[model samples]
Target: MMSEKILEVKDLVVDLDLDLGDGRTRPVLSNVSLSVSDSEVLGIIGESGSGKTVLSRALVNWVSHPLRVSNGSILYRGQDLLTLPPARMQALRGRKIAYIGSDPGSALDPTLPIGRQIVEKLRSVEPGISTRDAAARVVQVLDAVRIPSARERFYEFPFQFSGGMMQRVMIVDALVTNPDLLVADNITQPLDVTVAAQILRLLQDLQRDFKTAILFVSSSLGVINEIAHNVLVLANGRVVENQSVGQLLSTPQHNYTKHLIADIPRIWKGGPDTAAPAPAAAAPEMEPILSVRDVDRFYATKDREKLFGKQIVQAVRGVSFDVYKGDNLGIVGESGCGKSTLSRLLSCLEAPDSGQILFKGQDIANMKAKELLTLRRGFQLLLQDPYNSIPPHLTIGRTIAEPLLIHGVPRREVHDRVTATMHEVGLSVELYDKLPVGLSAGQRQRVSIARALVLDPELLILDETLSALDQVEQSKLLALFDRLQAQRGITYIYISHDLGMVRRACNRVAVMYLGRVVELANNERTFFDPGHPYTRALLSAVPAIEDRPYKAETYLLEGEPPNPINIPPGCSFRTRCPFAFDRCATDDPRLRVRGLDDLAACHLQEINVPAE
Candidate 1:
């Protein structure tokens, strides 16, 4: 039974200029053909620079900068989207085919109140609708996302909302008009696993209920396995493989797809810490390298809003964790859940509002002068966006060498260390002189890691560092981190929303929400038998690549995570928890041992022992 066709693209050829010393035109997407149906989710998986983004953008007349679609026929419902006039295309952008941009804030106007922005979307589609009526409609759409106080929040500015809330608002704005198709381009990368899963569930429900088609784009195969009915793999501006999700997962024809599937971590007979037999047992027991104790971080103003007064935004509520030598402590949470706040505190990039962060039993919050400079060598941070992390003006060599030079490493050894570190990150020496603009996203990320590693820090703080890298690059990098850990005992504080990576890469995992650690457990136990409601939600959200089908569980956590500022008393997760009771709202659960050195802060179960 063939599904009703919603969109079709045939022999799409997009041309762009290529500089061959002189100037010449080059075809970016050649003979690209694909289609989508009303009842199907299409997955576009690709490495960076594979023209996946370009091809997707071209669907909505959004060709990236300097890249124009010289030739392509994008048909929507038998109507040509490519040949449509500018005004017609603009009208079709939101009313018929919606786009949920990668950056939620940028997708929405920062200056406009979220409610007004959503209302404006309604008014745009139905110009005859009055402002009051549109406002009511806006509330209804926001309510669809289960955001609390929708009516009151209409006037709230985008900056006032957290990252997850902002994403929800963007989704509401996109869906308010009830578009036929939605294009989500890596929307969940900035969100934590729990919230990321909730968002995916919402999308799934919306797709099932509203019959909306989706072009879900992501670099993670695990995520694609969850939502996509069919998958399309792209690399270097070309399609590598396009098939049903079942075909792609069960028997991937491409080696790239196989690498992608293998990259996602799975539980073996033993746990994550169980070293390979080939590596022998020479590895020593790692000791505590960096410890964070009861760290609380917040951002706000001191003024009482002058006359009306200002309120302080609590980014990180009181939280505590540790990183041991050769250990990777994966902090998983949605964006704006204070994961980065904790990272900044550990790196001494930002100080906590309260509590002591002891590095080697010495408080780093109060480090001064030369001591601070010396302490920096012991810890370094690798950020998510490589473009922002590295100076575009500097060559790769200089970018990596700058850290060593700043620390007064000898000029002779600087080059050696930089080259060795670059190779460690899978970057070739030929790229040593290339600027960030000249490198691919994956290569640029490698440069970022190389720069961080050249300093020889005892601890590495990876803040979604591998988020932008493709499957192959990610696997190579993970292998590199593993080798570095085994050889040098370098500890890591890995902060990411991707659970698959966390499961494969980290020794232990910590789940965070609204500025607190909700759960902490080993990788195997965390996935197979989650102790906390939030942890279970996160695990259930992760899509497996194996043959098993996905079951939609009703363990729904409603409402956007509570505002960090003025967070409700007792359990922070209670407002959205499906199992929460009156007792949960009054008494906060302390972190306590449950099973096999695992700890979770939830009142539902005092001691949860995993089934054999």
Candidate 2:
């Protein structure tokens, strides 16, 4: 890290005008000042609506929507970007300064090939560069970001790529122009843990190799701690504290910062799985409400050159698990780990290719249309993107009542049930008439929960439902989940990439990798006494305050995951496992009981691992 400043913000203030019934202007940002030096990373930490995004946009002169930079000086390389000429600013955007957004799926053009998109972005900034040179540059950056089959994937559309691959494309696009300063705007928000950590490491490497100053903006303090040398805390658009990462983390001077740190879902487990808490007193004796028996789901991928795409994507391999009446069974893993696919099987939304998913002792795959509908009523699903899930034009009451009305519940009792469910989920009756746009994020999420609970389902499947929420809202919703479980006796299946969330809400967890559950144990054994290397790696990726001074060397998983369509012959994780040997290369290990409360599918129990 160098002392020479690369970018600076002086008294930056941003404002947005709302036209919802009443017109009002609010400060999206206020008197925010900070600087990033060459080869240094500055982390901006705050919650949603805290102006972190707005401030980041203003830095790059990207104020749109109802938002505008009211007052501030955005100095980049000793010049005010706020007042710079449009042509000059455009020239500076990709060549001298770059921006990578959070949602890569939306960021890239779905219609164009990835390589062509990169070439266009490059040529737009450097019109004088030759086409051949631009294409060459594209390949270089793609390889830099570790995109497998870079040359071949260059011609594929955005939809062909996964979330992690698209994120890598975002990074490659941003850095292909060789910008002097990079503004990473929540780039990792859409990624799973392992991919996010990998991207962070990539950014650190890019900084070292290119000497590019990075302004990292995110809502996660742990993400900030991972790569940032300096930390800037923001609350309600005001600068709360700006200090070194060490000082900010160790001796947080501001109360808000302390609260932010405290809210991070801590991993709390070390006891046995048999140690049932008071809320789940009957869990040990209860029969499973749902059982998955060697279920398999496959998808076909498009073949670029072949006339018929014959490639098979084994999305969910033969997997089995059981969900008790009152247990919160958490499913955790990186992207493409088949958690979502399993949720669909559990919810009766889709049928598996083989094997059986028994809900209330009835096989889902054999269920008739009417039986499926009945099953859906008793098994509800809560999705991650509630904004999209809740129809925008529909009123809250109507949205909640749609399910009940479809189930042939008498019209007279529908509104009454909706009202009761709204109250049950902690929503005010007044918001019933309002559209989804009128409610806050937390409220919208509550409305989502209310819609699911309105059915009074015995089994609730929350698939990354709380992942979009901030720490405080997540905590509140978690508490609501607990109360709902305690009061209504609804079983929960929380599928999340957040282990901390799993630790907090789940009694038992299944850690999946490459479409297989490598470890199955209660929260305590899963977090504290993990028998699988992948489980350990996932746990260590979390930034623990107790284990401060984050280092990149810790929790490093080398090489990219193998393609699901062409899985490795033996141990699927052997390519990245540090303890892999001759046995890992030839034989596969099945999930075996390791202790009284856990199962591990690794050769670690068969061999000794020498600590470095």
Best by TM-score: 2
Score every model by TM-score. 0.89, 0.94
Native-referenced Cα lDDT, model 2: 0.84
Clashing pairs in 2: none
Instruction: Give per-residue CA lDDT, model 1, range 1-612, as digits (tens).
Output: 778888898888787867565657777888788999996899998766677777878887788545767665888999888788888888889788988866876777778888987787788877999999988888987888867788878888888776677888888988888888888888876666656667887788888877899999987776787788999987667777999988987788988778667666553324435322222212345435676778788776655448757778888876877666667778987666788888888888888888988877788898796898888888888999867888978888998899888889999898888888887778899888787786777777878778888888788899989876766677778888888877776887789877667877776789888888988877666766667787766555565564221233545355567667678988888887767778788998888888766888888766443311
Error of 2 at 163 (Å): 1.2
In the range 459-543, model 2's lDDT, one tens digit per residue, is 9899999888777778789889889888998899999987667777888899999888999987777766778888877876764
**Which residue segments of model 2 deviate by more than 4 Å?**
20-24, 268-285, 548-555, 606-612
Count clashes in each candidate, considering only residues at least 3 apart in sequence or on different chains. 9, 0
Question: What is the lDDT of every predicted structure here?
Answer: 0.77, 0.84
- Deviation from native of the Cα of residue 512 in model 2, angstroms: 0.9
